[model samples]
Target: MRRLAVLLLTAFTAALTLTSTAGAHWHPKPTTAAWQWQLQGKIDLAIEADVYEVDGFEVPAKTVSALHRKGRRAICYLDVGSWESYRPDADRFPESVLGRAYAGYPDERWLDIRRIDILAPILRSRFDRCRRKGFDAIEPDNIAGYENKTGFPLTAPDQLRFNRWVAREVHRRGMAVALKNDPEQVGQLVGRFDFAIVEECFAYEECGKFSPFVGAGKAVFVAEYSEPLAAICDQAERLRFSVIHKDYDLFARPWEPCFP
Candidate 1:
């Protein structure tokens, strides 16, 4: 009986140690990557890239499988900060959590990040769906809603806390997460996210702000909608970012790749 008790205690200790180790390095950040974001259809799969970003819930599992077969990683794009009217789970959000319309998107409303206790579970369900669909990573959009007129008096700290929770939750599911935009917080968050996807950073002259990601050996995938293609391409190559020019819709439109 004494020997059996010792063995059980040893096993319990091992389990705790393993859990702690996983919590420390479970979400190993990506070192290098090239990715394509297409919220439209499967044509993105044919774009000859190392990674493809597809609509989180709308993409079929077969698409992820196909990307895997081709030695590519698949990322699921989810909007965790805004309530889209077209999403199937749109009604799941309570009225209290919904705020003013997202600045340019009339159909979408910013979510009150302060209601994280209530929102986390809903986001978990969405991330679970992404995992079930076999996505290798996640691209959470609208993370900077706090910087906008969200109608909730959101602070930078509020955005940072919510973004950190998002990173933790995604890592808990064994999937990598990328920090979208919110360039102001890049210095504080570059270590938390695996990679980054930025829009018009060059146009805004903020590309240098995100260089820490590449300095840490993680890839920065950028898309510019309005910059002169030639000028942006030059800067993109110089910065070592996987840069492309696409329309605002992010459909299968003409793309100007900066690298090769």
Candidate 2:
């Protein structure tokens, strides 16, 4: 009986240790990390970057393996706030939860985020695909639907609840999660998200709002469509943001990185 008790205690200690160690894998993005966003076309294994955010579904495991082999971090981009007609599981979403069409994206429609019970499982399955593909992090885009014409009557509190849930689940899976846009909630979300992924913040004069993330020692990755590198590079460098200039299509092509 004494020996059995000792073995059980040892097993409990081992389990506790493993749990703590697993949680520590949630690494924050580097302050000056170089990142490439290539959501379409063939995977460009030759891009110069420390991190690459690609489509969670389109990218295969082998491509993620190749990126890992090069000591590069792969971030899976998943749409959590909007339902697109192109996804493999598009039919899985019922019409009741689907809202108005996303601007400029005729096939995509905003989601009724209040239906977390229904959407959470779908997002978990999508994120699980990313996890199984060995992605080091997740860039959940279209997360700022509350600030848009989502047609769901979504309020700031509702967005907060969903975004926080996203961050919690991502961290629970031992993967880093970034806050995409939604600069208005930066202060509230900085504590929950691992980093900030901003687009056109400089152009919109919202770049300064991301200071909370940087101040919290979390990375802020900014992507601009038309801003000249010289125009924002210095300002971005001063803010320690990993800035990149890419085309709207996000085609696999050469991109300028302002990583110092």
Candidate 3:
């Protein structure tokens, strides 16, 4: 009985140590407010960019290392709401989880985020991949699909539950996560997400919606694809947004920065 008790105590100690080590290695804070979200390819070392937003799946670990060497943080961009058939792990997702095709993007389909039991593991694995690749944070795109015709009857509540879960999972993995353009829930989710990465918020007149995030002392990164620079720059500055004018494709293009 004495020997058994000692063994149990040793096991408990080992478990506690493992948990502490995992916690320490996983949680990385966002280094800066300014960042680039380029998913076109690998890190363009010649571009002299501060942050390289690369495809979470395609980008290799070496590229992340190179960016770190330059004292730059790398953000891994992954599609959490929509399913792209081209990804290597595409086969892992079952057909039932796939709903209608996303409007304008033929290759992508909306995911049934209601099925968290099925989808959470997949997303967690994706986050794990980003963590393994040395990514400091994650930018999960298409998070606002519930606002569009996703074919599934996704309510605001459904979106809220899914978005909150995504944030929690990323945090659990010790990675900072960004809320990507779910303007309606900004007030509620601002505290949950580390930052806000909004696309064309100026054009949509929804920049005001995400003020909560900025008020919470979190960074709001805005990218305007179609809005006139002169018109949006003033509002962007007033809102304290790190705004940039970029093309729709989001490649390494000449961007008009609203802030110095």
Maximum-TM-score candidate: 2
11-99: candidate 2 lDDT, tens digit per residue: 99987875774477556654765789998899888888888889999999999999999998888999999998999999989998899
Q: What order do you get sorting by TM-score, best first?
A: 2, 1, 3
Off by over 4 Å in 3: 1-34
Summing lDDT over every window of 10 consecutive residues in candidate 2, give the lowest-scoring window: 21-30
Please provide, for model 3 over 50-123, each residue's C-alpha lDDT reduced to its tens digit, 9 standing for 90 to 100.
65677899889998898899987788899999999899889989999999988888889999888999998888
Residue 187, candidate 3: alpha-carbon lDDT: 82
lDDT of every model, 2 decimals: 0.83, 0.87, 0.80
Q: What is the TM-score of each candidate against the true structure?
A: 0.88, 0.91, 0.88
Given candidate 2, what's the lDDT at residue 174?
68
Better of 2 and 3 by lDDT: 2
User: Residue-wise lDDT of candidate 1 within 1-260, one digit each (tens)?
Assistant: 99999999999998787566436532323333345778875556567667678898888898889889998888899999999999999989999999999877898999999889999889999998998998888899999987798889999999999999999888777788899999999999988898888999988999999899888878788888888767876667677788877889888666666654
True lDDT of residue 200, candidate 2: 89
Candidate 3 yields a Cα-based lDDT of 0.80
Model 3 residue pairs with clashes: 26-174
